[model samples]
Target: MTLDFFSPVSDLVLAHNELLSPQALGKKIKIHSEKKGFPELGDVSIVVFGVLENRNDVNYIGEVFQLNEIRKIFYSLFPGSWNTVIADLGDIKAGETVEDTYFALKTTVCELVKQNIIPVIIGGSQDLTYAMYRAYDTLQSMVNLVSVDAKFDLGDSSKPMKNNSFVGKIILDEPYNLFNYATVGYQTYFNSQEEKDLMDNLYFESYRLGEISNNVTLVEPVMRDANVVSVDLNVVQGSEVSLKQKFSPNGLNGKEICAVARYAGISNKVSSFGVFEYKPSKDDEMTSMLVSQILWYFIEGVNCRINDEDFSDDRSYQKFITLVEDQELVFYKSNMTGRWWIEIPFLSNVNNKLKRHTLLPCMHQDYIDACENKVPERWYKAFQKNSI
Candidate 1:
């Protein structure tokens, strides 16, 4: 079905461009803007991807700005040859399916990685997260994912784009070399009883927003062990945030989001992160500029040139993780206070810290031995010692 995007709202010459104008706020949700002119990307690189869909009476206007908006937004942020943000323009047609979307997204990301440029997906839906890993599949065993959102996307079933089930399929299906995957700022209201049960069984770690607000100690490492971070914008506070199928009155604010993003960037574990689900119609006058600033924050995080104003001098992270930490994770349990916790030391991959990692940690009897012995050595030699 061809979703009727152009409403009889305003008399703006937006029809002059590819994107149409909305007559009022919170009514129509299509917010696609075109990139006006060609721009250069020397040492700087970016790829902004956007997509949208419609369901029944609801128009899923998740793409923040259309192709035209892409052009203006990029130049507006960087001004000159200081940066290059290529707009990976999504389609206006309504018949796009998951597989089709996958093909488009996979191709785009692969191209970006091939060019050695980081891709920025503004998001049409959360399923794009899977498309991202698919595009960049080398993350196996080495990748650490940090999701800053309000719900766990660790679902095993449900339609691909149904809600938060997409990432679960990836984790379950792939031989992912995932180090530590953590979900931040989850709200109790959004998740069902069954979902909670599933998460507990799956062992995917999650932190409730209430916990973070109540205790500042829990927020730091939320993005700490992560090598790749992706932010679903729906995690933001609904009172000030617009454009969505679901909005929570209690969520992260702009400063909080910036703080989290800055943390993710400084860790250097973050290669590329994305911001999804912003609807232009529901967006406030301040929305575009805020998004533009958000884009700048991302750039500042990745750039070789450092900003002392926002630089994270917290070398405490150095004691915990490094590029090679994922493969060499051998934990020693500590009976601290009342609960038992493991202190995992970071080791260089070249020095061979993976005393336990193998083709499948689940399949190895050595893993069983190590877990029981609390020793990675006994397990490591088992493969060589027991093999005749």
Candidate 2:
């Protein structure tokens, strides 16, 4: 089993756990340790693990890092009134080569996902998202990725993969499982003109940082449709994190980032989630605490999940149809959660990535816009991609 790829949590972290309150997360969840080996997974709903590979950070200068501090902080926090079973699977150390590390992560994530357990990965660099995305190769035919970052990270695909350019590799690489990619909280100055043009030319979605900061709930519908959600810690404002982790002065605050994590957790379709680009430093208490709270909110969101996506039952949802510029748009609203979804009509003549009719998550405003004879940009992009 891929569990063999993991090393047990350090003795220091476990010893620290002994001092936490009984209601703390460390005292409640199953954990891997030197004494107990691997934990039982039969009843686990969420699994947390760390990958210690960051050689591809672009600015790497042979510095080593660990997740012990983050683990200690996370374990000390009190969990909400949650019913989900969580496990700390410990860390996957950097292998002899980066490729070996990727293989281990991909295999481990594949194992957990096949068992219907969500994997919340804490990573060495944002490029590890490529490994997380690769884990879905055999499990899913088409994958939707949502990245919360300050930059689009679409570096030149011709060169080797770095944390800043891994998205380029994901798009150009083989197997072609990626169906849709969205960037949330992207800072305009961080991305180049070509990268911005590429995002538009490909029909991918990107939300500006100002836009997301103004309305954090805009992430909910985007997360609702994602299969993999990768968050770059650098997306958070520099003031909110450790000195070493400060990537931008202007970015999401702690509260906004936690809300984004909760949205990812609440998504019924999101199977794997990751927080990346964490750099260990001497004064990392604030960063650790923030990361811990992000995990807490995600688990809380998972506990609050409602199965309101099933449209087979007419009583579960309300349907509305509107005409916009000679085209008829159909919308469905969940009676349980009051969430909205717009249908993407199937094109029989075209070879479509989505073989059947699929519901694209949208806001209530999208429906209102359709009633005014205006097409939602999201619906238009999905339709355009389907036709291509």
C-alpha TM-scores of all predictions = 0.61, 0.99
lDDT of candidate 1 over 1-388, digit per residue (tens):
1123211212232343224233221112123334332223344365444444322112443433442443234334432223333333334332355566565655656665666667666655565666666666753335556788898766655444444676667666566545445678889888878877765554456778876666534444444345567787778787555453337778877777766665565443355676655555544434554555566566555553222221134321121111221344332211221111123332344444234333211112323444454443322332332231
Candidate 2: regions farther than 4 A off: none
Count: clashes, candidate 1: 16
What do the candidate models score in CA lDDT, each in turn? 0.49, 0.93
Worst 10 residues of 2 by lDDT: 350-359
The true-structure Cα RMSD of candidate 2 reads 0.9
Q: Listing every candidate in turn, what is its Cα RMSD in Å to the true structure after a full C-alpha superposition?
A: 11.2, 0.9
CA lDDT, candidate 1, residue 185: 85
Return the lDDT, model 1, position 132. 65
The TM-score measured for candidate 2 stands at: 0.99
> Tens digit of lDDT per residue, candidate 2, span 1-388?
4766899999999999999999999999999999999999999999999999999999999999999999999999998999989999999989999999999999988888999999999998889999999999999899999999988999998999999999999999999988899999999988899999999999999999999999999999999999999999989999999988887889999999999999999988889999998998999999999999999998888898999988999999999999999999999999999999999998989997886338999999999999999999999999999999
